[model samples]
Target: MKNKFQAILLSYFLLLFSGSACDTPEPGPPDAGLYHNYAELTQELARLQAQFPELAKVVSLGKTVESRDIWAIKISDNVTANEDESEILFVGGHHAREWIAVDVPLLLARNLLENYASDARTKNYIDNGEIWIIPLLNPDGHQYSVTTNRLWRKNRRNNGDGTFGVDLNRNYGYQWGGPGSSGSTFSETYRGTAPFSELETQLIRDFAIEHQVAAMISYHNYSQLVLFPWGFTNAPAPDQTLLSQLATTMADSIFAVHRVRYTPEQSSDLYLASGDATDWLYGETRVPAFTIELRPRSSSPGFILPDRDIQPTFQENLPAALFLIQWSQQGGTMTLRLK
Candidate 1:
């Protein structure tokens, strides 16, 4: 642990003076400010909106069981008006234990907003396309993980029958209550009483559907993988070929940045999960949706990825994200290649 932390410090020192990776500025190691509690996260989102008023519009999708507002920040050139821009959604913290998940997408949001004035590529994306970020999907669960247990992974809802939370990831509406889910309220993968029963999951689904989001990326952690539907079972989607090719391209982009081997796979390949957000988004919308499991898929760190890993994870995935935005803008009509 000491050596690992030391290596992170060394990397930070090196990145402090590095030049741009390509068109965008190269990312430095994450500092203490990278991690946040629910209050801090909310404040940060408000700060971004205030700072970039013209480019950012903050909206409350709904509220959690604990009455915390579920916010999604929309970043575009004209934030006030919803132009017919190709919009893509990026969400994080589906499981509160995955601390790095929250950091990764939030960092991406910060990157795009901060670099808009200087980075032409970033400016172009914001000016022409739209990016929606819901940095903390399960704030109650996230806060619970931070305060009480370090591995809490569900919304804090008293399940009426002597239980306390439902895994929001397993409560989505598609193929729900099937395999990889549980009726046992104590289980971490409990699917809730019914599909979209949880307010948090319902808010996410409604917002995505209402906005007609062109593509989506639900971030998770501790496994270097780019996964897509059908998360419920092993059966591939009809457009699996197209989706797999795109996943490989994104995974390759991540690998190019740091040689992190993020293989592209069907979600079921890792674990059979029904009612997952990935399957519902892709299955219902027919849009390109993915779930990226980010860096250091090991038990040593697990969901507690060190702060230094945060920036590199974001740096490596930014290219893949840019590609997704551009692809979504192109109306999902691109050719698939094995490269």
Candidate 2:
């Protein structure tokens, strides 16, 4: 009888444990909405990793000026294969007001991985090379745009003397404080107290060195222009022929979709900019780099690019970005070849 009582007690304990376990719920799919915050973005990253363990992994390059995680997605067929092949780095949201910047990178990430198995073009690129995407580089600024001011343009780094934030694009080591770099901390074009002084800039610099990038695209807003290196001067970069060919191909492809004229030229020729990412990437590593300013010109409120424009801008820019990937992987010419 005592043995039977002990057996009943064990069965009751098992039932209680099973009931508690059943009460726990599973997580739902990641929300891909445009207004998703930083936490949601991180959750999306986790979901992508779980879904495509073979193709995606998160890399915490460093912390932002505001101590936010600066995350990057390294997508390829295999980690070993990535090291052997050339890398193409695509970044967006360098400027906070450019809300459209986030969609492109995130959508690109989604499209590339989602279509990796079926899309021959995506398959070929991943099979042969690495694609590094740093979407929303300025999390502090990006979040601020979503919550506070829609026109915020720099990392929220204390610049001292009562000034706050720094133009990360103009805080790189290349030609810092040179022409086009404003001295005033309050200015949008402020180069920062020193080169790479902002943690956000340092994250980019470190990532570039580690990846040995062959080509890069820094997406921006307002101006529908394809800008190359030499942001600090009018002189052309050494790989002018190759860079120009790529830019023309991209511009043509972009125009075919939207029919918008995007004049391709050196940055200095377009507008003066110093200590910028494209120049540093091109001038230092001789990698072909372009600053692609997207749709909704300056007349429009910068950060309020509508959701309706998202699909069209993404569809139009897809071909151009894919062209860059194709060029980087093949290393010969800029041509879109999709089987």
Candidate 3:
């Protein structure tokens, strides 16, 4: 398994990042197939762990209500060392319909690992800071989106009143049952029976506490927006200046590439989302956090995005993410431009 993993990783590395002196595989015809599914994702995670045993470790954070593993991968140059480092957590697939969300984090994992030695910035970040990527947070929901429905947005947990799932976004412990939360299980924004009632959210809470994470960015799709903390209410987090600066810098870097309009605002600006991940992370741990809503706003609808958009989306986001790491290392704030 380990040998196979090394081979797979090496092949992807050669094809995606480096094209010099590496063995190029045969030009097989592209299959009219869909992107990777939950099983395939788990397999990819295992393979990554096997290939980069020293730098990567696949941890079972917790299980979903359906008993699916909420897997997490920790990528750093030195995992055994107890020394503290600026850690950045990147999560994806919080909303089940966003298929591209899964790929972005996985792409980030490969990009950082494949270019660690060659790319100076990536190398510095990995060596000086830990990058944790939870490629798929809602495994059951993601799987359901691929198999049964294309619009599933919440986790697969029966709320005991005929409604199926709870919006994991509104299930966090911070400001539970607050505004933007609906008691109606029929609604898409159902807040679950109680905060942290779902094991999936609990797993994230545990991971945050155990790691003492410094910063985090969760990936979502179709909004073309970058959102900061204080989602539960309009009030900003204590480190509002720092958060704003980082958010602005990230937004600027992204705009330079695609020249797209991405507004960085608090969650309340979009809509009051109580007990959201961004609010929970910042409100609880005081770790700077942001939710990055990625690509194709009006041009595309639903989860189906073309294969051609994948590389470009990854490229645009890469710079912004790296800037955050650089900002953290310098102990600088996220910048914002006043109109």
- TM-score of predicted model 3? 0.84
Candidate 1 versus the native: TM-score?
A: 0.87
Give the lDDT ranking, best first.
Answer: 1, 2, 3
Global lDDT for candidate 1? 0.86
lDDT (Cα, tens digit) per residue for candidate 3, span 101-165: 88888888888887876888888888887788998999888877777666789998887776688
Ranked by TM-score, the better of candidates 1 and 3 is: 1
Give the per-residue Cα lDDT of candidate 2 at 147.
Answer: 65
- As for lDDT, the candidate ahead, 1 or 3, is 1
* Ten-residue stretch with the least lDDT total in model 2: 23-32
TM-scores of all models? Answer: 0.87, 0.85, 0.84
Descending-TM-score candidate ranking: 1, 2, 3
lDDT of 1 by residue, 63-165 (tens): 8878888778899998999898888999998898788888888888889999999999899999998899998899878877777677778888898787789
Residue 309 alpha-carbon offset, candidate 3, angstroms: 1.9
lDDT of 2 by residue, 1-339 (tens): 999999999999998787558643332343225645567777787788789999998878787767788888888998434468878899988998787787788778888999999988899898788898988899888777666666789888877688778898999998888998888998999888889888887888878777778789999886777888888988877777778778889999988987877778778886789999988877667778899888775666555677788888788888899999988888752332211
Cα misplacement distance, residue 73 of candidate 3 (Å) = 1.0
Q: List per-prediction Cα lDDT, in the order shown.
A: 0.86, 0.81, 0.80
Is 1 or 2 the stronger prediction by lDDT?
1
Clashing pairs in 1: none
* Candidate 3 residue spans exceeding 4 A from truth: 1-34, 80-82, 299-302, 332-339
